[model samples]
Target: MSQLKEIIYNCKKATSLIERKEIGRLTLRESVELKIHLAFCSVCRIFRRQSITINSMVKMLFNDAQQRQTKLDDTFKKSLQERIEDKLNKNGKKL
Candidate 1:
């Protein structure tokens, strides 16, 4: 049927639906279409898996960065700068 063909053959639409599903944005029709497409499409299924993985990694990276919002104190900054200067002087490199 033409409907079946439309559902099963649109990789681009399926991939867009996958991303929309990840972000909780898929409409009911889109959700059904993506599910039907994924059921028959191995390549799109692989893409969906990879997209989930990459999304999780990016989320973890941002979460870790947010949790580690540390700042160096003025004294620590000065000490680090002095150490760098000393190293550069020893290597005869002027900054």
Candidate 2:
């Protein structure tokens, strides 16, 4: 039926909105349509939850790493340059 088809469409749209949380509020028609679709669709519900969980975990991990610096400092850089120059001079290279 046309009404059933409309319900399915709304449900898919709502799942997408829930994933992004950008849909403020649905009209009465949209609310009814989404409810009907979600009532029978378990996969969409699970997907929305899992996406949230994974996003949160990744954000936390990134925040922790952001507090640490992994690169060498100026002294280390100078030491590396000296080693390279010494090796090059020993080989009679201009660089």
- Model 2 over residues 18-74: C-alpha lDDT tens digits? 654532666677666666777777877777678788888888989888878577798
- Measured by TM-score, the strongest candidate is 1
- The TM-score between candidate 2 and the true structure equals 0.51
Pairs that collide in candidate 2 are none
Q: Could you give candidate 1's per-residue lDDT for residues 1-95 as a string of tens digits?
A: 69989889989989988998998888788888998999999999999999999999999999999899878899999999999988998999855
Candidate that scores best on lDDT: 1
Candidate 1 Cα outliers beyond 4 Å, as residue runs: 70-95
lDDT of 1: 0.92
Off by over 4 Å in 2: 9-12, 22-32, 73-95
Clashing pairs in 1: none
